[model samples]
Target: MSNPNYDQILVHIIDYVYHTPITSPRAYQRAHIALLDSLGCAVETLAHSAEARAFIGPVVPGTTVPNGFRLPGTLFELDPVKGAFDLGALIRYLDHNDAYPGAEWGHPSDNLGAIIAVADWLSRSQAKDVTMETVLTSQIKAYEIQGIFQMKNAFNKRGLDHTILVKVASTAVIAHLMDLTEDQALSALSHAWQDGHPLRTFRQAPNAGPRKGWAAGDACTRAVHLCLMAKAGQPGAPSVLTTPRWGFYDALFGGEEFMLPRPYGSFVMEYGFFKLVAAEGHGISAIQAAVELAKKLQEAGEKVSDIEKVTIRTQKAGKTIIDKTGPLRNPADRDHCMQYMVAVTLLKGEFIEGEDYADDSPWASDARVDELREKMVVIEDEQFTKDYHDQKVRSGANAIKIELKTGSEVPEVVVEFPIGHPKHPETLGLVKEKFRVNMQKGGFESATVEKMIEMVEKDDLPIHKFINLFAKEVPLKT
Candidate 1:
């Protein structure tokens, strides 16, 4: 029997992947920056987080795949599935990679886990002429697919994690990289949709933990695995999205179809947030406001103890997601907590870093941080919410107001765009600097760091060559 017709969403995605050519210079430029920045974030995770390192590498020790992808910042050479997981986990573990905010917020760079792994492995094993340019193109496409879906879907509101988009985006792009036909690509994508999506519970209070950090990695692994299955001749559920009771809509989306607000393109890569600081995307502006408020307190000779009350006015999404007020159990919990991030910034008079969220970090145990958290109130600003969801003006606006014990109110500090926003004047420079600092923190020498940056800037570097620059033989901790 002839195959049934594919869903329009699947058809659109496969068509974009196969026929659409990415000619936007801005998209290419942003993809290059995102590549460097994401790799830098991965290296930084290797340097700072033992918990993250422990989760990487092959499932069985002392096993290696021929012509496998080499994970950056380590000696492990893994198959594409494990490679995707390791790379994705590293980029996302600290939650410092770039993010695209919309009805559903997620880090578009999370797709890099699958893109880089599949490209690098294909280049090595099949002798395919995959270059950094190809990788960047795939990155742009993946970001566009995931970002566009996020623009109109509130997966979190349905109690699903946004990594569901990551899985779908990565599968579609990886299928293209693997040279799967449209039918196979559709089959792979259908499998991705049919796969069970993890709940958002791991990212919320009472259950927030390391699973939130590695969720994207898990998605990337599934993407690679599903594509490989499709390449091996698996058939697709053509109507997976529109199937009556068991379809994606009815089973997971409350019987509502996904709304694509725009055509697939490079807009997401060009406009996504960089996340220079180590806080949740929604709370980055709040952290900036808190840092500024801390400076004001220091200038006025006021201590954190003098703050009688603190009011944080933020977007509705921010209030819904990151406005936590209880004991944070881990880095995953703390980083997502607006109260924790703001409290740490207020106490230190500096922006919160990845180290600040560590369990052993002084700030994590400081009673003053909790005291400040107790004094702070988070409220949703309707205008901020509207701005956050506006396609023309995607702002994660946050305002902080402070009242002193001495009956004086500090002028409210409002940070509408945050430092990493594209509209911010210093975003480009800071993004580059962030990559440099991350490389240095990951233990690369100054000259080596410069060389890596230069290599990443080049358009024709082979995928294997560019990926190998990040590999070093650090003895794995037992």
Candidate 2:
């Protein structure tokens, strides 16, 4: 095997799968969830925006392939590359895609657009039979590619975006699933290298809106495009991420070489999260811990009005990104603001996905959320901070402590990881359910989704039939 130290993750994963055996019950489970949730997000956002349709809709007739992943609300049966991006953009249009928490932000599940697009397209268009096992295997490999990279690299600090990892991870995984030769996989990596990443404008304010969600899918879509080109004798720029002056590390990453916390494996796939609520950023963990504490206080008969101050101690990442103080201007801002999210959850006993962000949050007029925001002092817990840096860990840990006006303080409720953490019981079950429910709710209810999930899990399903099902028509937007 080639030395991984010198290999980009895209190249390294291809080489690793060649030599090692990788699969598990957990890996298979996560694959199903990743597919379902991503599709659900895609379907939900399909009719909501024109940018989504304008960008992703071309995939259908653009490619010669008739049977491919059927993007909701459109008739495009795209080639794998276009399919990946189309699907990615659809799911991510609202900035609601999944995330991998760290000192620097990482979106682990972003590559799903690429993985599912290729898997869906290949199984449908080509005679290649895709099974649950193959899909699971692909998910695991993709997760490892994205997750392991996020463990050490801080992309945002260098003025780039996290979707760059999506590009690398998706390209390598697609290359592998297509059964590309080792040389071909390396070529795909080169394509990924030359495929430049978008700026971080999508994640920040003023301009910060829904684009952050689909950015990864965009990266993945291009990944499939490059891989197919390489298969057709197209050349790739091998040192795309690491050329001395114009390479990825220097051009985008502040000249810092990509440092991986671990070798590629099924580890990341096992631990990915499904965003139950729409606000998916640095607060997945803190939101859970604080929500739990809020419920406990509410159960104790303490009204939000009686709450004088709320103190939340957590890893610095949660505070730095989501921890905001002021009048939130939009849904994007409200979702990320620590005090606002916690306050809504406490006030209504639930977090509304797309409620009154334009007008005031019902409690928006309530001085209490702000009162809570003011009383809330976000401090970094040393242990939480320490756990966040550990390589073995994926999501940054979070802890919340609340103080009430009644002069009684409950024991601090600290969630080591959010509900979506790999170790958490909810990650697998909730993620898949979230996908199925959201998709059905969005309008593309079909037998194909179940068959697709089954194929991903058991590896014995007839992949062509599944792909053909996507070609079947559904309700069009009126």
Candidate 3:
């Protein structure tokens, strides 16, 4: 029997994976940076987050797969599926990885969890000859796939988390990495579409918690699992996206078809934002604005205690996602809450760090933090909202004004772009510095950290050898 016609979306993804060749030198350069940056973020998570560390081992302790992938920054060797979860969770736990803001905001680097796991596993077990070059190419393609989908699709508005894109993007690239035929790749992608996606509630107030940290890991795990199933001869639901009432469009997307505003390429990687400061993508600018205001206060010998009221102006997406005015339950909650981040930064007179959001951190329990939060008002700026979604000008703008108790008002501080934005002059240097700091914190020697950075630039470095550099046996805290 002839095969059924697949949806254009599925066909486009499969074709891109098989046919697109990454020719952009800039994309590869950024991918190299992204790879190291993601690993550094993972190391940072291992160093600071006990909750993230608790989830790092295999499903069953002491169970090991021969020729399993080695998880960076730890000695755990596991099959690609579990490795994907550990790596994904570690890279994303702190919300410090790179982010792409759009109709649907996400971290494209999240797909690196699946890409690195599969490539390392294949090279070790099957001797597939996957190299750093291969990994970079895959990273570019995955970023393109996820980033393009995010450009015009508003999945969050439909109450779905953005990790659905991570799953689909990872599935496509893993199929190519495993040398699956086009038909098999289509099958894998169909399964990704058919899988139930997590709700956005875990990222919102009153429900925000640690699950937000590992949702990408869960998506990467599912992606690798679906690819394995497809490799084992699973059949695909050809029209999973468009098959009437039961299709993804009708069932989950409210009958709106997914949009691809641009063709598949390296645009996402080149233009992605790195989180130099550990906060939600939408609130990075707000945090920067708060920091600027805090600096002004410090220069004038003003204390945070003197501020009677704070007003934050942000984009609509920011208000929709991180403008929370309630009790933040954990690090995940605090990082996503604009008021909490701003209050913490203003209190410290510096940029917010990952630890500041931790439940055990003093800031979480500080009455001053909550008091400041209570006094703040978050309002949406129409132009900021427009610029945030505009294809030609994607800006995460936030303005802050402080009203002092002495009956004085500080001029509004506006930060249109946070550090690590592509347009920022210091982005590359700061990103490299962040990686160095995170690597050393994860137990790498300063010399070795420098060596690893240099090694990632080599195109022909074997995948397993590259992963081995991060395989230190750091003991987990009980």
Candidate 4:
């Protein structure tokens, strides 16, 4: 029989998280919106054809956490691990999710990897009675864990995707949900330590496409598997991050534990941006710049030909990732290409998903777009760079100051915080809207969509029931 000793510890932690009330308002608020936004992402992404389906999808996504925590649209019940991966992937599959500028790691909503998987498995298979409170607590705990680890953790710098943090956080949260004693929690962490992180090859060029979005889901899957093993009396190695030789410090982290410029708390969730578009983070600034400039030129009734040049100054990440000057072969390239977003915005006077760049129908390479691009010089602004590094005000905001052949320079407009900024407010309303949009995109009926919004808002819903709602199996399009 499975060792009851390990099981008890796991069960206890899960119980505590499930029962604990959320006192932090920000945590509670973030939970509600993230719930909708994440669900939406899952709905929209799972709607696509490229997604893998059925057969061995998630036969028994474990059980034990709480009720109402089901994988949206799919009835293939699963362990929390599978649930986490599925839900996390669903949410992140679309590039439209919340992010933190301080997180330099793409998006923060990726935590769904651990939250969904662990919660479902514990409630379903393990016979745990998880509740809304439990989900919130665990969600917060996982967010804190991931965000804390992210303070100084530069995964991309190490050529690893930021989703590694999701794995770490999810592992910790899973252990907590399992009611693992401190020792058990630590043990689960050991497994995480033992398991190496994947290279960021999927987030970069050529291969840098949809996989970048799914990397977080993959991490959650690994987190659940490790947690389960730990709950089964598996041993873990200590000092995984600092060990000599093959240790993470050398083999992975390069002999450094992350340096925290600030404490890990609700900070990440609060400041994280909800991507209004699908392009990578670095390109946001450039896109904003292009959009701003296009607005002015268009208002003047001027064509792209009248434009003298388009110049963009951005951070190192933008330069390294999206600053392309060639044929954008696919949507993946088009998404990140600074010129593409800018060019499309200028020519069409708008940038929408279907119009600007879709896999099937692509915008032809226009000389006008190129003309603006040729004259466009992108450089790094020293002050903008400084502001970006300021811990107290960490932002992914961009400043655009453009000049025209008309001999007048457009006023430099700076956006320290984009829409959905936790500090800027209205995030809840925005997130709710986004969630509805996602559900609609997934083709969810009005009734199903309304039920989800109501359930999430009450915060008293069971994890299993939540699962059942999503269990409708968001169908894939041909």
Write the residue-wise lDDT of candidate 2 on 284-397 in tens digits. Answer: 666676667767877897777777667777677776667777776656666667777777766666654534332444755766667777777788777777777775664456
Taking all chains together, each candidate's TM-score versus the true structure is 0.98, 0.83, 0.98, 0.85
Q: Is candidate 2 or candidate 4 better by TM-score?
A: 4
Q: Runs in model 2 with CA error above 4 Å? A: 1-11, 17-19, 44-56, 59-65, 72-75, 93-98, 297-300, 351-372, 391-396, 405-411, 443-456, 467-478
Q: Measured by TM-score, how close is model 1 to the native structure?
A: 0.98
* Candidate 2: clashing residue pairs, number: 12
User: What overall lDDT, based on C-alpha atoms, would model 2 receive against the true structure?
Assistant: 0.66
lDDT of each residue in 1-478, candidate 3, tens digit only: 1233888889888888888888988888888888999999999999998888887888999988899999998888999999999899999999999999898899999998999999999998965999899999999999999999988898999999999999999999999999888899999999999998999999987888899899999999999999999999999999999999999999999999887888888899889998899999888988888888988998899999999999999998899988888778778788989999999999998998999988789999999999999999999999999998887888889999999999999899998888988888898889999999999888789988988999999899888988888988764542
Clashing pairs in 3: none
Residue 280 alpha-carbon offset, candidate 1, angstroms: 0.2
Q: Per-residue lDDT for 1-478 in model 4, tens only?
A: 2223443323333343434454678777777777678667766666653543432245444443333345666655555666666677767765667666543455667877577656666666556777776777677766665665565567778887778777777787777677766666666766675776778876556665656656788888888878788778887665555567877768886776566565445555555567666556666655655666668767766656665656676765566667777555555566667766766765666544522555554465555655666666667766666666677665666655666678766666566655565556665676787777777767778898899878876666667567667766548574
Off by over 4 Å in 3: 1-4, 475-478
Candidate 1 lDDT trough over 10 residues, lowest sum: 469-478
* Model 3, CA-based lDDT: 0.91
Backbone clashes for every candidate come to: 0, 12, 0, 67
Off by over 4 Å in 4: 1-22, 49-69, 354-357, 364-375, 401-412
Local error of candidate 1 at residue 342 (angstroms): 0.6
Q: Taking the tens digit of each residue's C-alpha lDDT, what string does model 1 give over 165-200?
A: 999999999998988888899999999999989999
Model 3, residue 276: C-alpha shift (Å): 0.5
